[model samples]
Structure formats: structure tokens, C-alpha cells
Target: MSTILFHEIVYGPVHSRRLGISLGINLLPYDGKLCSFDCIYCECGFNKDFRTNTHLPERENIKAALEDKLQSLRKENAKLDVITFAGNGEPTLHPKFAEIIEDTLFLRNLYYPTVKISVLSNGMHLTKTKVFDALKKVDEPILKLDSAFDATVRIIDRPNSPQYSVSKQVELYKKFNGNFILQTMFLRGEFEGNKIDNTTEKEVSAWLELVREMNPREVMIYTIDRQTPTKQLKKVPLEDLKKIAERVKQLGIKTNVAG
Candidate 1:
């Protein structure tokens, strides 16, 4: 039942496995989770378990808080590799997500001109014009696509939308024109009474076909790195992750594996 939640609007310059030294921005409520997907493996636990009563952070408050943190960091001359949009839940769910990205870009340029801005999204809000364009503005729009099949996605990501499909996600990713980073969480285990594994030959081959079609700038393949809500889940080993990355590499796509 253990979980992790960010209780601040602007927090962390934590070492991230993928993004390096990162400053996190939590646009969701500080007290609970508000995500578009209720993934079984989510570290924040289930959305129903952490029902939020607090409002999403205001754009103005986010701007002010972020600017203040950047200003302080600048004064201290801290090494920040990236400003990441990730928190208890989906960042693009914020009403003024686009404006907040604009604000973040301005502040980033003002404070850490070279530091990159990255958004770790579930790819649920890409259909929203503002969210799509806002994601395009960042240096890295790391979008998730855990499975090539809708059924597997339903079991893994448990997206709130019944309309979510791998084909639709691929179409949206195609719009990026190979500019986005595709992130997939590879894991094996059972959820509820069903056996789940995205690493099997069938799953990986189908996923690879989509990956080839999207032709994203890079693919990040990794496994569970922390305690997940579902106790049945198990991490994919580094050697196995490397093997997957090799498959991606063979397709002439840049890949990164984090075990």
C-alpha cells in the first residue's frame, strides 16, 4: 500500500534515471492524484485511493513558484539538467497547460537557458490541440505507449478513455514527425486474476511494428523502478531491457534502457 506523491507545486532537483538532474513541476493537486489513467503499476497508487479535494495549481501560482525556485537555483549555481513536468498525476490535465508551458519556457530561458524542458505524459491529452502544441514546444515530450494492443493497455495503463487505442496513439505520434520521445514501461506479472506481460515475443513484435511506424526520435525502454500499487508485478531485468533496446537499435531508432 506504500506510495509516493509530490506535495508541492515546485519540488525536486532529484536524479532521474532518464532525464538526469531534474526539477519537477506538479500541476496536479498537491494533496492527491488526478490522472487520466489509473495504471495498476502507478507509484501514486489508484486514483480512487487518493481522491483529490484540492484544486489544480493555478497558472499564475505555478509561474511564480517556478520562477522563485529558478531564481534561487540560479543564485546558488546549481546544476539542473532538465525541468520536468511530472507529479502525482497527468500534467496535461491542467486547464491552462499550454499557458503554463509558455510560462515555464520563459522562465527557463531567463534562468537556465541551456536546461531542457521535458513533459512525462501518459499521451492521453494529445487529442487536445493546446496539449499537443504545448508538448511540441518542450525539448522532450516523453509519451507513454505501454502496449500495442488495446486490451493489454486496458490491463496495464487502464486509461480512463474508452476511445484510447494503439492505432490512434500511433496516428497522434505520427503528427510529431519523429520529434517526440516514445516511452514504454516493460513489465511482467499478473494484475487482479489476469496474467500480464508486455515482454513476450508477440507483445514486443507488435510494439516494434508500431515503433517502426511512428519512427520517434528516440525510444526509452525501462521497467518498474519503485514500489508499484500492484504487488504481483515484477521488473524486467537489465539484460532483457538491453535486448529490447537492441531490437529498437536494429530498426535504426535510437534507444535508451533504464533498468
Candidate 2:
């Protein structure tokens, strides 16, 4: 099992295979991963291992740290392609998430106006109007939707919300009016005692139908790239990902593959 975690509030201008020169903004926890979903393929390990209701950084502190980093990057004349709001876990879980978004946008404009701002979220908070509005303000709202089937989602994402449903989330996504990007993780694995594979015809067909409905700007189809907490999982091949991309493109939607 991978116990990978980010240890800072603002870390990295790391090179990303999909999004180049990405600077990461950690809004979860400095010492652990806190997410709404305990995904089997998460590099940050299981959610229960580091679950907590305390030690969340204040909005002022996060803003200060982010501005400090941005100032240094500006001094160095660093080339940053995107400021990604993603770390060990979900970013919107922060209590002051909307405020943080505002602060981040202000800093980005002040220090690097041309650079894009992105948020990598699980989309669980879209029902929260503040979070939804905040997402609408970002340059890239990369929302996750791994499977259209609730049964497969339970095994793959393990969403903490008991009332979570694929149909409900699809409706929430529709509200974005094609401004969002759909991120889906493709993998084959066995968790506990059940076989989990989200590449079947039914899974792809149902997911594509929802994708057509949402009509997002783009679809990111990627496979596991690191060690997962669940040892039984296997990464889907790049060829398969390309195939999925082709199917997605058939709907007149652009697709990007990351693995």
C-alpha cells in the first residue's frame, strides 16, 4: 500500500504528463490525506488512516504561504503552466474553500496572471452552492466521475456519502453547462472479495451517455500511475485508454489521456 502524502500547504511546480509545469496547492492536510472518497487506487492511501476533524489550516495561513511561494517563483522567473488545487486528497473539503479560491485567484492574478488555475476535486461538494460557485471561478474544474454505475462507484471510489448516486451527480454536473472537465480513472482490481473492473461495455456506454448529457469541455481518461493502497488493483494499459478516448471523442468531445 502506498502511504504517499504531501507535507506542505503549497508544494511543487512539478512536470505533469498531461498538464505541463504544474504547481500543486494542498488544501487537504499538511501531514495526511483527507478526502470524501477513499478510493482504492489513491496513492495517498486509505482515508480512515488519517481522518481528522482538526488541524485544518486557516485561510489566512494558506494565503500567506501561497503568496510567499508565488513571490519566490516570480523572483526566479519560473515558468508555471497551471496552479493545481490538488494534493493528497480532495481540496473542496476545506471549511474555507470558497475563500481560499478567492485568495488563490487574487494571488495568481497578482503574481502570474497568464498562468491557469485548476481544481482537482471529486465533485462531492457540487451540491454545496458555495463550492459550486467557487469551482465555476477556476480556469479548470477537473471533476471526477469514474463510473456511471453506482455499484461500480461504491467498489472503486468508496464515497463516504451514503446518499451519493451517479444520476444525482450527473444532474449536478449538468448545471455547469459544459464548463467542467470530466476525469475518470480506469483500472482493474479486486477489493476485499469482489472483482472490480470499470472498462466493460456497459460501464463505458453508461458513462458515455452521461458525458454526452453533461457535454463537458474535455474528458480526461487516465489509468493508475502509482502504487495504490489496494494491492490487487492493476493499471489499465495506455492502448486501452486511447481506445476509450476514441469512444469519448466520437461524441464530439475532446479527450486527454494521462497514462
Candidate 3:
């Protein structure tokens, strides 16, 4: 398996393809990953490794461990650009997600005061009041929106709820408005026997429509940069990514490419 699994609350200082040198906080289990969306391109594998009965670390424990780690790193004058909430599954799924975010804020202020806190969420829980509120507290809440079409989203993200529709997701994004950074993983390939492509002219047009409606602070355009769990997926080239970013920019939306 991959060493992305951290035994405790804190891990990394690892190079984040998008966020630079990041210190990760995995609120999920150390032994496995847990996320609301079973994305075909998930780099940490899948949720089969997750044991639901296993308990997540308590808030006090998280605070203590994170403070200890950050304090130690501060003493060493370590370089860290972001404290990211990322792991095997979804970090927002933790029961004390709000408390943990608060604690992380407290620690981030004390030690790396300039370092931003980011959450790489699937946006499945954005409908929940608590989840949405907790996400609001983070510095950069980068939510995933792989597609605007219901069928395409289902094929790509494989969201658990049958009722989780693109319309509902768009409704949720309306609430975030400028507070959120919309991230779409632009790529094309085959999964199972179905042909998949989210970077085509049709797909890009739909995405740009949403970007214009949401008016997000920025749009992060990128393709697969690692070995994904699925074998048939193909990466979108850098030129293609830049082209998509340029289209998004034409709509007056700021764009960043991590291809």
C-alpha cells in the first residue's frame, strides 16, 4: 500500500502537486481511507480499507498531537506552505470536523501564522449545515466538481446517494459563491466499458457555464499526476489543461493549472 497513511493525526511536509509543501492532517483512520465519493481516480485506493467500527482520534487528542507536531516543526523553523485536510478518505467526514478545524486554526495562528489551511473535500457533505459551516472556517475550501451533468458525475465520482444530483450540487455552490475555489480534474479515458471524457468541447462548455454562474474566486484545472486506482484512465496533457484554463479565463474566472 501507499505510505500516505499516517498513524497519527499529522503527516507530511510532503510535496502537494497543487498546494506546495503541505503538512497533512488525516482525521480518518490511520490504517485506511474513508471518503464519501469513490472517485475512479482516487490515489489512495478505495474505501474497502476503511473499517467503520474504528474510532477517529478525539478532539483533545487531535489538538494535542497537532500542537505538538507544529510546535516541534516551528522550533526547527520548518517550511510549510499549507496545512491540508486530506487523507485516505474525506477529512470532513470526521465527527469532530468543526472542532478539529477550530483547533487547527488555533495552532496555525500560534506557529505558522502565515500558512493557509485548506480542505480537499468531495463536496458531498456541503449540503449539511454543520459540514458547510465547518468548511467556511477554512482558509481555502477547494471543493470538487468533476462534471455538471448528472450521468457524467455518477460515472466519475460514483457518489453514494442516488439523490445527489448535479442540480443539488449547483444549488450548494451558489451558497459558497466566492468563498470556494472550484476544482475540476479534466481528463478523458475509459472505465469498465464506458468511454469517459470531461475535457471535451461539450464538457468544457458545460463547466464554463457553471464557472460563470458560481463566479468562484479561482478555478484549479489539472489532470492525473499520479498512478490512479483505475487502469484505463488517461491523463489530460499540459497543453490541453492550459487550453481549458484559457477558456475559463475568457469567462472572467481566475484559473490555475497544476498539470
TM-score of each: 0.99, 0.97, 0.95
* Global fold similarity of model 3 (TM-score): 0.95
Report residue 106 deviation for candidate 2 (angstroms).
0.8
For residues 137-225, write the lDDT of model 1, one tens digit per residue: 99999999999999999999999988888899899999999999999999999998999999999999999999999999999999999
Candidate 1 accuracy as TM-score = 0.99
Q: After superposition, how far is residue 47 of candidate 1 from its true place, in Å?
A: 0.7
Output the worst ten-in-a-row residue range by lDDT, candidate 3: 1-10
How well is each residue in 27-109 modelled by candidate 2, as lDDT tens digits? Answer: 87777778989998899999888665658888999999999999999999999999999887899988899999999999999
Q: Can you rank all candidates by TM-score, best first?
A: 1, 2, 3
Which lDDT tens digits does candidate 3 get at residues 1-259? 3224567678878998888999988898777777788788887775665455667878898888889889899989899999999876888888889888988998999999999999999888887788899888888999889988989988888988888998788788789867889999977899888899998788889878988888888999888887877788889889999998998889888888998
Please give the CA lDDT of all the candidate structures.
0.94, 0.91, 0.85
Estimate the Cα RMSD of every predicted model relative to the unseen true structure. 0.7, 1.1, 1.6
Which residue runs of candidate 3 sit more than 4 Å off their true CA positions? 1-4, 49-52
lDDT of 1: 0.94
